[model samples]
Target: MCSWMVSSYFGSILYSEMPFNVEIKAKVSNASQLAEKASQLSQSEGTVIHQQDTFFNCSLGRLKLRDLMDGNGQLIFYERPDCGGPKLSNYSISNTPDPEGLRAVLADALGVKGKVKKERRLFLVGQTRVHLDTVEGLGHFMELEVVLKEDQSLEEGEVIARSLMKDLGVREDSLVTGAYMDLLLEAQG
Candidate 1:
């Protein structure tokens, strides 16, 4: 079990204890084509969401405030390897009714690292969530997150993630190793 603490800048924060997932991210050459395949596989049109993610500097792991832009948001802290292909991510989330106020507190206390704004089309395929993201300044990408049950092993999650990647026509060569923030920071330099 990983142990960490977040300050009570936001009152009544919800916490999930060490939930993990096996996930992959890839650069999408054709957004519409991938969206069609994802929709077909899931048998439903995905939900469209606009997100503004503000990353804060943290000594351990990566912390970000995800503003859903619909009066709801999540403060997420996650730790995962910065490598290509399917990898395990251990994370926790806290829901907030007032994201703007929380963002201000976190930004001031931690200092801002960067921000990523994107339009995401989210699909549910079995136990997995397929995200078709159009990221500002970074183009389109597809992410597959296989949410692992408590009894599930990491290999099982990886198998599921790889299968979804194959189903979505995500090539190994197109796989990206890091978050959109890393890409944006690199582009600025």
Candidate 2:
């Protein structure tokens, strides 16, 4: 069941301290090539992350707990439009010291919606974070998260996103509309 729930739980997320996230996501046919291209533009070694994101049922917003193989975990809540283009995602992430305990708590409290497992290759390009993902049930995908500075405007973020899109060879038609959890739910049906 594909769902986007909006909840009053937004206040529970650490929105006051976190920066606004401007981002875009696209399905990549050639993730390796795109990673190579991103690497060429930015001289940085990509970090490989094996992650599992477990979503929970909420009343108003999307909430998920992301557990990384590196032992770091986070509980994330975000409210963003499901548009197939560049969009500003209002989100908050709180680091978890006990991911296993929290996962069990959230599962028993809200009920688990779905889970998404992926191996992500992350690269940094100036203000943007590039992710080349190979999902377990899905496939290859690329996501760009442009972290906006305190003084930066949304338009500026869009400009940066567009430039990176062109550089990374991401096409408008390849953009996806919802979260990976949504896709996973749809695939199940």
Candidate 3:
């Protein structure tokens, strides 16, 4: 359960007003083992999601259209620092029924940057969302997002994230900075 409102529909678009989370991403060697541990810790089966995130060049922050491949999509704008440890992120999301049209329009307007396609296994543990992602051409990764409450301090969120990392056996050495898109671009160069 995220502290922020999931979405609000205005006209044809559903928006997630403004929310912040403390998060971290890490490289994982054994996704299955991590998934098993995450599932056990969460006490529930995880949901599998196939996502294709197409990024657009934005002057400030990162903008991307996420196509779920199920006829639904999300347009997300987020700003977070590139760091190995947990960091705060501010983000907004809008849901659109027509992703192709939106993607084309955004591409024409902002220019396409890169795309990341991944199969994500999502698990919820308390207020945190644990994502075990198998990214195409990248490899396995795990992300922990501690959705912060409106009144919560950033340090509180980081503490939660760090505890979850320990429980999941995530070592500090395996942490990665930046998004999958950055990794993809670096690989290309």
Instruction: Output the number of the lDDT-best candidate.
Output: 3
Comparing 1 with 2 on lDDT, the higher-scoring candidate is 1
Each candidate's lDDT (Cα)? 0.88, 0.83, 0.88
- Order the numbered candidates by lDDT, best leading: 3, 1, 2
- Writing each residue's lDDT as its tens digit, candidate 1 over 17-42 gives 68878889999999999999999999
Q: Quote the positional error of residue 78 for candidate 3 in Å.
A: 0.1
- Expressed as tens digits, the lDDT of each residue in 1-189 for candidate 3 is 232322221222222447888888999999888999999999988999999999999987799999999999999998776767887777889999999999999999999999999999999999999999999999999999999987898779989999999999999999998899999999999
The Cα RMSD of model 1 versus the native structure comes to 6.2
**Which regions in candidate 2 have their CA more than 4 angstroms from the true location?**
1-18
Q: Write the per-residue lDDT of candidate 2 for residues 5-112, one digit (tens) a residue.
A: 212323344346656767899999997799899888778669899999999999866899999866779999887667677777777789988888999999999999
